[model samples]
Target: MQTAQRNSLRLLQWMMVASLALPLGLFVFASAVSWVSIRETADREIEHSLDVAHEHALKVFETIDRSLSEMAEIIRDVPDADIVAREQMLHLRLKRLVTSLPQVKSAWIFDAKGHALVNSLVVPAPEIDFSDRDYFKAHVDADIGTYIGEALTPRPPYQGAPFFGVSRRRPSEDGSFAGVLQASVFPEYFESYYARIGREPGSYFALGRADGTVLARFPIIDRDIRLDRNGPIAKLVAANPMAGLITVTSPTDGIERRLGYRRLAEYPIYVGAGLETSAIRARWLSTMSQHLIFGAPATALLFALLGLALRRTRHLHFEAERRQQAEEALKHGQRLEALGRLTGGVAHDFNNLLTVIRASVDLLRRPDLAEARRLRYIDAISDTVTRAAKLTGQLLAFARRQALKPEVFDVSRSVQMLSEMISTLVGPRIEIVILGSEEPCFVNADASQFETAIINIAVNARDAMEGRGRLTMAVGMAASLPNAAPLPQHPYGYVAVSVADTGSGIPPDQLERIFEPFFTTKQAGHGTGLGLSQVFGFAKQSGGEVAVASEVGKGSIFTLYLPRTAGSGRSRQPATDAAAIDGSGTSVLVVEDNAEVGRFTTDALAELGYAAKLVGNATHALEELATGAERFDAVFTDVVMPGMSGIELAQEIRRLHPELPVVLTSGYSHVLSEHGSHGFELLQKPYSIEQLSRVLHRIARRDVGQEAASASS
Candidate 1:
């Protein structure tokens, strides 16, 4: 009896001890968790605050920018608005804006001499001289654009004080400088907007220039203060061009905060948001506290009960192993997908290089080379380079990074051309059929990529057939697909090109994954698995779709639906005046920023028997034209250069001298729209000596004929 009583008492004592210890441990854990939770919550709140402020600041900035741009555009179009009339109209516009927006502090105009013509402030100051200001000069001399000044000013006489200004040059139709159109708005206008943006009480908000000139701040509420680029916030500004959250220690508070920055390119400003670290930690802490608080005691009881009621179930371990394997497989698939995209981009650039080399070599293989063994050797050198270029192009096309020269071409013609190559490619084992629409279906696709895709499919089909099969090409329209959007159509229409193969069909399970990058069922050495992926990428990039249908016992069909058009019939025409080239006495002005390129161009022009004068940039070119008044027959310039683009220079020149002919050259031709105003001709870059000579001759002849006709009239 004594022994049993002693054991029972010991057990009871142990239970009491555990009960006391549990709460003490819970207290420590809960407190730690709560601290973390509170900190995280605070951090999140701060971030939210900052984000809201940044967004609000951006909204205000955009509104101001848009309003000013509209105002400038309106002023430019107002025909009746001479100096006096313009002052009156501007006052009316300013009053309306101030009343509607409630943020615009003032709007004013500066005469050519920088004296205020009109002020929109409530108690407007008398005209002040701003001629000495660099911004004033910048606006006056801008030539083609508005000049935006950094945020700084004395508080305005208007209800809303302290303003930044944007000034644009106003010119008369007769080519005389009219005056400067200036729009000024209060910094508080932005700060107020920033303050009201959703954010935690302690969140920081700032708006600044790309160079870190602080324009507005919410908490600090400072105007005309610039942030040091070497500071923490400035570092965040420098790094966060695309805008995402980052963690940084606050220089002001010495506490870590998550920072987010958004660049407002339209306004050329930066919006920054900062959230406290404590805020993010708060949520984590709260959940963790709740989990531990209730879970500990419940878990202890459950453990005790589970131990008593435990029963083993078979196959649990096997199921777990299978799940782990599947997870690993999924991870590997994702990695492959990323790698495929990277490889595709690399391949695209390689193709363009190959195209250039191929063209160069083809041009070099002249009978004139037969006169000397030296000439033959040079031709061979060109051929070798061309072959290597072709290989690089093949790789880049597979990778999908090559810049595409897309055009509407017949799908049937593409198939027919591929058929000619298929006999040798498939070793006479595969029979190729070209089934095309009688109506001539067309698609906006790069012809080179299209050919590559067909070849890859043929290779795959050959492999599936084990070196023997029938490949049927069927061209038609795809009735709407489940997930596919309607293909974009030009004046003509759209069609679907289907390549079907009779061979060992793909397994049902692998069918869905067949188009996935680097996925293959072929023997290890037979394929790279990028063939189908390349086809899919090319189709997608070309604004088309690819579809697949297959059965294990039957065959497989891949449909490439593409937009079509009636043949443009405007076939690629070779230069007609190539044989009759004469650039004698043709005065040409060449505007290029690169010193080496400019020198090479002038030297090349001189060699081609033309007079060439090279200027450093568009600004210098414009200045030269204005001051020298040199009557050049043509102005040849690079489209993309520092200061002013070739397009802008062309526009300015046409305004000044309408009779001058322009030929713009660039590596990138997509920006031709910017040159549309002057109807200038475009020449793609990396031109050879012959191409330059031919273009110059053509321009010179055209100009001479026009001048001659005008003189006779």
Candidate 2:
């Protein structure tokens, strides 16, 4: 039985390893293939662009030659007529024909005398006309047939007339040549063909004639490009090959362009098509880059799956593995809950102790002492109190009771200010890098809580590094959640502050439990185990969430997603600046349920020189107001008491007094419960003597009108 069991276990272990190893190896192989494919794709695109341009150039040349040949054929079929009569009649007909064909610049007839006989243009024939011009010369060379001449443009007198011409001899019945007929087509006729090539932004095409004249370009050519090397169109067709490709500077943007050129024996000129190399390659570049980017995470996931399979294969005891996991989780939770209780208890005791210490410090200051000695004692007291306060804050964080008084703040500024403090706390052995955001992301959260949470996470990161590693703190908006993981729900939009550490990564077994209170991997006396717990609590209380992800031997990342507040990036209100209030003295009645607190308030008001009346219950207070015998400026009362609720009583008083000022106060009172209402202000309990004096002073100074409510509790 033992032998069988051992064999079974070995088989399972092998299966797991094979499962994991195969997929991981496959992923790495696929990634290598993908990279190669991307490079090859770019190369292929460049080649394809060259091929298309070459084809287009050939087509354009063919079309132009075909059109010219057809015109020549028509001219050749016309029988010869009397030279003088034909010249006069032909001039009128040729002008109409040129007008009918927009591409035709001019059509003329020349006798062997080298004088223009008739022409499409209204200008008279030149005194020194040449019937033996290149078009006529070409026709003569071809016997009595038609011939298409090379691209030609007026050199001087007709400088703007850049065009190509075709010539044909009008033959007599005996097969002798008559006066030659010639037609010139302007360059603008080719504009439509060039415009068809590049339509996308950043893409352009140009046509360069064999002689290096840029016939047309989709985008306007620049002056600088005229000074540079001619475009690939001209360069490729320069040798006058049937078809070829080359690279040259663009005539528009001066960007290097690749062009395909084609020439034909039928036409005297070569045609070239140009496309920007970058534009052609851009499509494939984007495609391959996208594939490469997606491949990273895809490959990672594939390997992870394989690793999971391998691990399962390696472990034959499936039941035991599950049991182990459950046991660990249970232990983690219990430990955390215990830790929370422990921290809470410690915090409570410490606060009491701190209070006593503070009282003693205050009392000690009253006694006379040596100036230097007193200063030293005072410093010690302040230091101790401050440390105690910090400790209690950590406890509150762990307990999820930290106050979240959120307001707009600049994330970058906060990070920069904390850089020095983080360095000091993290120690010299650890490197701290603080990266800040360029744009401000504001959050409505308690700044102190936010600061503390970041610090706690940093401390945890430092600890993970075992005091010797690099830690990076960054503030930025959360990346849109990928399809695989939807964004976790949040009360407010999120801004993520992340702490990353290059140190010992968390074990898989401990990852899920890291945020649990009191869960620690460190030995006793080395850790409190509440660092992450406090971070988690603080995040949750602030209407946010904390997430942690890690891999063994790699590293860990902790992200705090906070609520985005309205009016982002706005300058925050200064906490120390007080809103001023002025008051006019009017008769006032004070109501209180607690004697010491009440007397304290009344006495403070009396010292401020206000005639104040006091009562104990809401009913009596309301009755006093209902009676017309006495009138008061404001009704100040305790909210929670034996007789009546403060809010209800306030409602009644408002109805009765109508114009009286009613302010409620309480210790553990929800007197300010808005109840879906607005416009009232309730003073908090344990109010200072000065604070009460101010409240009355303001109330007395206000006008008693049917203003409803100006503030709310």
Candidate 3:
């Protein structure tokens, strides 16, 4: 009790010090603030103006861009119109665009020879040639995308002012460059918009090219606005093209202004909007002149007032600080408590899985076990391993380190195949209905992981229904997903797999955090909270997204969106019975650092009628190959080992033994990224005997074919 009293007294003393510090600090700050310069005010104003102007510029550019793109699309898809009729329709449309948006000087459609096929303004269009124009020449030679060229002036009476051509090259039916669909936008359009950016007199706003060519400027001093590449503003813009503030003296007026500038991300143009620093300083000085008079008096009064207030609030301050500390301690405890709960939950789930495995193994140890009972134990063990693999897969996915073995397959077909399995898993009480679109829904991703994600979602829905409701899996095409990341068929289509359930839906508070790792709404000891997280991570890593919508007491729909693929027709191959395939004394060198694993590989190879040799590392394998290359027909290597990686060993083998086949195996390897298996055969770990037989057969066939070709040569 005496120790508690002493601690309380010390806390009170510290609270008193803190309470006094605030008022003293405020007094010192108030006194010192007058001495600090006001230069940043000008920069702040300039930055605000630049940001606003840049936004407006993007909108304007987008408007013009969309207009041109639409026009081009229309002309490109003109659907069997005669040359004369198409030209007339194209002329009218272009004219409408130019009139609607005053910024568009003209839109032109021209053939490969630069002959003007149609123009927006020049009716009975003159036989004008744009052959000399860089924008046209660029498309004619080789244009990968839209080209923004330097300013060009009309030869005759057409808008004496210069215009920059933003052109997209037209492709022929044969996929060859055919023509150019050009939008010539006037500089005056940008200049007019920029004029409103500066409220102060002599202030400026301008747009320049990435290559330091001034395109347009406000307060039109003259037409001769182009400067040398080494000019101050040009140099500044070139050095920091994305965004920054730089003081530059106007070449026309010789007035240095604080400028805020940004380079347009979509286009090769830079925009700068600014106000004169001198004008800003004058305005600030005028406003602050009155405030300066009361500084000393105000500071003195404030210090005295705070001293009295602190004295009166001493007890309150001590109580409040003590209460705050207690609240913070409570929150920290709650967080730690929450973490402990999570740990306990994960540990309990894993322990249950391990118990399943352990019990299954013990059952398998009984010599008197019947064949059917033994099979049941094996299935249970396999199921537990699968569950454990899923847990770790989710962990790896959350860390963004799970390697993908992507192949294109139809999502609709995969769903159809999984329907029966899902029905059996969910039990008879839950009705599984699959609603597939008539159109093909294809995706490029790891088929196994994709199947796992769908199963996880399906299982989640099943649980939500408490094993007694309808679960509907709807497959179709989606235009946009919930996230901002770009996918395979961006802005066009995506393969969507939605699992919806008529269950007691989740509350809004819990719904938002469903995708977070180890976040579950299930009762403790029932879930590891990694199911939905795996779904989330797999979708994201495959360049897609997962979206969930739930209504309380009604139902919930969980959708996984994957990028659309053109269906590489790479279906999952059904493994044949391993016992049926004869390895026929084909020599296989088993490379694994782990003795148990290496022994297992060799035993399996021997069981399949293949003569096998065991090597501990890449060094031994390389030495074996060096001494007798003909003795080994293939190398079955583990991906991650001590000295040299399997991929590196594969590279070495490819260099030395061009004719020999190398098969790499890994459940998950840091070194075996998707690219590592490009030209080499891969046997995923936990592979069935049938899958092993299937890969070996394929390798043998490939070897025979290579040998035949070499003999023919």
**Candidate number with greatest TM-score:** 3
Q: Weakest 10 consecutive residues, lDDT, candidate 2?
A: 669-678
Residue 352 shift from truth in candidate 3, angstroms: 5.3
Expressed as tens digits, the lDDT of each residue in 153-202 for candidate 1 is: 55333233556676667655766666676677566776666666635544
What total of clashing residue pairs does each candidate reach?
27, 18, 0
Against the true structure, whose lDDT is highest?
3
Model 2 misplaced stretches (Cα beyond 4 Å): 1-344, 351-432, 438-440, 459-469, 479-493, 503-534, 550-555, 565-569, 577-713
Higher-scoring candidate on TM-score, 1 or 2: 1
Give model 3's TM-score versus the native structure: 0.57
Quantify how close model 2 is to the true structure by its C-alpha RMSD in Å.
Answer: 29.2
Better of 1 and 2 by lDDT: 1
Q: Write candidate 2's Cα lDDT for 1-713 as tens digits.
A: 99999999998898678766766675677656765774455345444644555565556445434544544454454533444455555566677667656666877766655567567675455555665467777655446444555556574455674665656665545665566667786655555554555454344444453445455455654321222235454444546467665676754555876555555345444454555667656755665566557554565688999999889877857878898999999999987887676777566556665775776577567767678877776766666666555555565666665433456777667767788889998899998888877766787776767777788888888888889989988888864322315545543457888899997899888888787665678875566666777788787766678888788777899888877654555554434624323333445688887787778767767765666678888777877876752467777877778868777787886776656667767644333422311244566544555566667656642442423345431
CA displacement after TM-score superposition, residue 6 of candidate 3 (Å): 42
Which pairs of residues collide in candidate 3?
none
- State the local distance difference test value for candidate 2: 0.64
Which structure is stronger by TM-score: 2 or 3?
3
lDDT (0 to 1) per candidate: 0.68, 0.64, 0.79
- The global Cα lDDT (0 to 1) of model 3 is 0.79
Q: What TM-score, over all chains together, does every model reach?
A: 0.42, 0.39, 0.57
